[model samples]
Target: MSKETRLREEIVTVGRSLHMRGLSPGSSGNISARLDDGWLLTPTNACLGELDPGDIAKLDWEGNHLAGKPASKEAFLHHAVYAGREDSGAIVHLHCTHSAAVSCLDCLDPHSALPPLTPYFVMRVGRLPLVPYHRPGDPRLGEAISGLVGKHSAVLLANHGPLVSGKTLEAAGYAIEELEETAKLFLLLRQQPVRLLDEEQIEELRQTFGAQW
Candidate 1:
């Protein structure tokens, strides 16, 4: 199979995983992988649980739809991150339950939304900044994500969900899963006093694992 064909299959597989696992429901998420010329993105309003590899949209680097279904409206959002972080090979944006709940909370720190609760969380999804609220599909939202590019591989959109980039499709999918799990844990332990990883320990992980903090 060609590289593009493999990428389309990867998207379908990952999207189904997210849907079955309750990370993405209805048509509330978008997934994309970088292409040599542009990108292969999940079609707009397509259900993650029902995506067909043949229906994936192909677009040029300049954003023109070349074939298949129309691209997701949030294509610009993916483009913004790719433009900002050349290292990113794929992007996953989802309205997973816990992450969206966390986004709706009023008092989260914009710099680091979630604390260092687990080593895997810290390693997979480093310091997650909470982006300011913008209406879905707004152009400004993409600009906001672009602003955090290299420094943060992931961001939780205020009143929305998590958007994560990775060096590969699987990496991006795994990071977002970690983010959602951590968000669920955060909510579960909200009322209890929990021991978060200290700065020293966090630094150690960052240095050893090269986590994007």
Candidate 2:
């Protein structure tokens, strides 16, 4: 199969895996992968659980639709990240339950990293910044993401969900899964005295594993 065809199949596989675990519901998420000439994205309003490899959309870096199907309306967010991070090979944006719930809370620190609750959470997903609320498809959301994505591999969209980029689609998916689970843990422990990983430990993970923050 051609490289494009292989990417399509990979997207479908990952989408199915996420949907099966309820990370993506209805048509509420989009996945994209970088390509030589452009990038591939899930079609608009397409359910992650039922994506067809042939129906995935491809668009140039400038956001022009090249083939397949109508691109997701939030394609610009993916484009913005790609423009800033050359190492990001795939991105996954999802309205995951726990992460979206955390996004709605007013306690989030807009400028700081998400609380480092667990070792894997810190290792898989490094510093996660919160983007100020913007209407879906607003260019400003893309701008907010672009401003931070260079330094941070992930950002949580206020009142929406999490946008995560990785060196590969599988890596992106794993990071988001870790993020969502961490959000769940935070909610569960909000009333208790929570212990976070110290700065020293986080730095160790960064130096040891090349963790992004």
Give lDDT tens digits, candidate 2, residues 78-116.
Answer: 999999999999999999999999999998788753698
Query: How does model 2 fare in lDDT?
Result: 0.91
Candidate 1, superposed: residue stretches over 4 Å from native: none
Least well predicted 10-residue stretch by lDDT in candidate 2: 107-116
The TM-score of candidate 2 is 0.97
* Whole-model lDDT, model 1: 0.93
Q: What value does the lDDT take at residue 139 in candidate 1?
A: 95
- Candidate 1 per-residue lDDT, tens place, 113-144, comes to 99899999999999999999999889999888
Local lDDT at 95 for model 2: 99
TM-score, every prediction = 0.98, 0.97
The Cα local distance difference test for each model comes to 0.93, 0.91
Candidate 1 C-alpha error for residue 95, in Å: 0.3
lDDT of 1 at 142: 86
